[model samples]
Target: MRPQLHLTAPQNWMNDPNGLIYYQGMYHIFYQHFPYTCEWGTMHWGHAVSRDLIHYEHLPIALYPSKYYDRNGCFSGSAIEYQGKMYLYYTAIRYAKENPEYIHVQYSDDDLIASQAVVISEDGYHFDNRDCKHLVVDVIKDQNLGDVRHTRDPKVWIGHDGYIYMVVGSKVSNGCGYDGEVLFYKSEDGVHFTYQNRFIDSSIGDMWECPDILTIDKQDYMIFSPENIDVAPRPNSNAVIMPVAFDEKTCSLTKLDTYMYLDYGLDFYAPQTFVDEYKNRVMFGWLRMRKPVEGENWCGMLTMPRVLTQKGGHIYQQVHPHIQKLFNQKTNTIDFDEPFLMRISMLENEDVFLGGLHLYIQDDCLWCNREAISIHEDKVCNLTHTPPLNQRYDLEIYYDGQVFEIFINDGYYVLSQIVYKIIKEQTKIKNIELYKLSKIQ
Candidate 1:
């Protein structure tokens, strides 16, 4: 039950996407990988390349726990093209207990300290961790500024002001407890960085992870995963996007008042974006699995790349054109047992049912329910409610046999679910366009 439209590890475990960039001629995607089992273990950076985003070619492991600073694991980070070389920045992890022999045998836990590090590749494919690893940011010694173990996930980029800017997520150690904040840094060259101020909000969450910065249509936005948020109902964590203003000289971000969830789905988290070859802002996210498959060798998968834009401070996402080209084989009916893509135009008081999933319009809002699916009982959450639809309801749905991704009104809202088995199906009045999707190998 692997995904063909989305990317997964060649075999074992995979998590948050790391080092996503379009460099040289191919687009590269590096991810957090554990090679031993289907479960999480010590981390390494798995590498893959694709000329077109639909198909991929797996490469060697890019970064591993080689140096003393990152001996425990190599956590998540980003990549950039600097001076004709590929600079890959990542969070290097080291544990308090000294057990070098069991690094690959044990799963990472709370007894770890993290620092930011970099590895350069003269070419896009070769990464020599033994000789190329350099520790750029050391572990914090002062507990008042940030938690020593939780400061990590360096996202580096070259700003329009001709300087390299980096954002690392952390938990600020307040007198009472901790607050979520993002640490900023600046550099003339990509190697060495100087500390700058941080952006914090007491109401955001207790901690943040995998912070990303991007500018769309002259507007700046920060995307991050907030942990242990003070909310009635939540998943393991949540991904949010907020509009912000950046100071190039000070390397700081000013957060705006309102923020929105990046995805209203139970299986989405840790989204990272990069500029495509055509300069389109593209995003990829980890589909967080609530429970591991009983006998499968792989555990996690990524979401389909979404092209992003903004209007009135709200981010809009849509399926990439490259993915749309694969669904050229049109059909009159869709089979839930196979991979397929379907689009429908929904009207007020209209309800559409595809297999076990249901979509309906109620009180001018778009709603989705997956409670009828067999895997609904195994999920963290199974219902989605969108804000007012303004009477426009165009829906696009993709089912890769194991996962179902629904896009409402060209991505104004999205809900993704994992469906193991489709029990029943009932279709309403339909003017539908259904197509078969090509396999990705």
Candidate 2:
């Protein structure tokens, strides 16, 4: 079952939200899309726009693999408005005709990929490569830049210093082994980027992808999904947040010892953020499914937009205010057969046990046990720990079709998953209030 409100490609495979920006009174979102199949293949930048975050209209394919520099695919990147023009900085991928030695020798010639390019648009809808030369940044052979094969996913932003800064994900060889590093670049104009330095080298993972920098309350935070991390209870790919302090004069980042997981869930990754007209740091992520839906034509979805804030040395995420307008107040009890929004909280001086496929808290953790309704052999259940609650705990759940999004304590922690089962029995929750979602036009 596809989502009713969450943004998904009309058809085919989609992943990694790219080139997110708000310009000219519209929110433009581009993503990694494969139009021909339900499986991953040649990637193109799929386009969509929304006047409000909740209602989206799919636009034409934004960027295709046409140029020699990006003939293979138009990979993930970010967008920025410069001089009344919107510029998209993307990793243009083209397979090498011959295998590069730095890449593993076992890889086939067709498997070798290179990332390099930028495109521009005047009206925020139409984009072309003619404005600037394609492949603005070429693959580097320098040992310090690490394995060129792993470099990609360019995220660019205009800094407080009024210079455009770009962070490209790459792997660095530190003699003994390769580690993930984010290479930094600067430009006075949107084009002609100059390599400044590598911003971060982390021992947490071997490669980093989808690097993003968010400046919150004068603190620069670097966020990325690292691959090959051996941490227990971690997904194959997970997003991490590193607190960094940036020096505009020198254009460098000093990473603090503190870092944390962006989301403690299985389905969240490759998030991109944009500053809204309200000056809020809004974020969205590709909600990754571990396995394909049995009968679906489309294969990916994005999480609901969240506003991010930092306080007391912790990052806080809350649902964007725009989304609350979609809540229908006609009902207070959920109808299991249809899409609904449910808010639950513990009763005063009361302990309650929710039954029949409902979420509940236990031992300082939020748990979802769907074994009662699950059709698959593998149990559909998960738990994420949160700070101990002295009183009632708050949870908001949005059930749209087969997907369920759980926001705990006003989004301090979130859990999103797809469940295929239909509840056959009545479920009860403490002080629950249910509302239907307004139908999307």
Best by TM-score: 1
Clashing pairs in 1: none
Alpha-carbon TM-score of each model against the true structure: 0.93, 0.88
**Candidate 2 to native Cα RMSD, angstroms:** 4.0
Query: Could you give me the TM-score of model 1 versus the true structure?
Result: 0.93
Tens digits of per-residue lDDT, candidate 1, 1-441, equal: 677778988988899999999998899999999877777778999999999888898998988889999987999999999999999999998888756666554334457788999999999799998999898988987776777889989999998888998999999867777789999988888889888888888888878999998899999899999887634444757888889998777877888657777777657888999999999999999987655566677778889899998877678898888997888888876766667888888888888887867888988887777777635333367777677889998888898857888888878878787765575446453898899876544
The residue pairs found clashing in candidate 2 are none
lDDT of 2 at 268: 78
Instruction: Please give, for residues 79-186, the per-residue lDDT of candidate 2 as tens digits.
Output: 999989988888877667534553212235235466667887879888775545367788777867655567888898888789988888888777777788888888
Question: Which runs of model 2 end up more than 4 angstroms from their true locations?
Answer: 97-110, 129-133, 230-234, 290-292, 328-330, 346-360, 370-392, 424-426, 439-441
Could you tell me the TM-score of candidate 2? 0.88
Report the C-alpha displacement of residue 221, candidate 2, in angstroms.
1.2
Quote the positional error of residue 64 for candidate 2 in Å: 0.9
Q: Candidate 1 — worst ten consecutive residues by lDDT sum?
A: 372-381
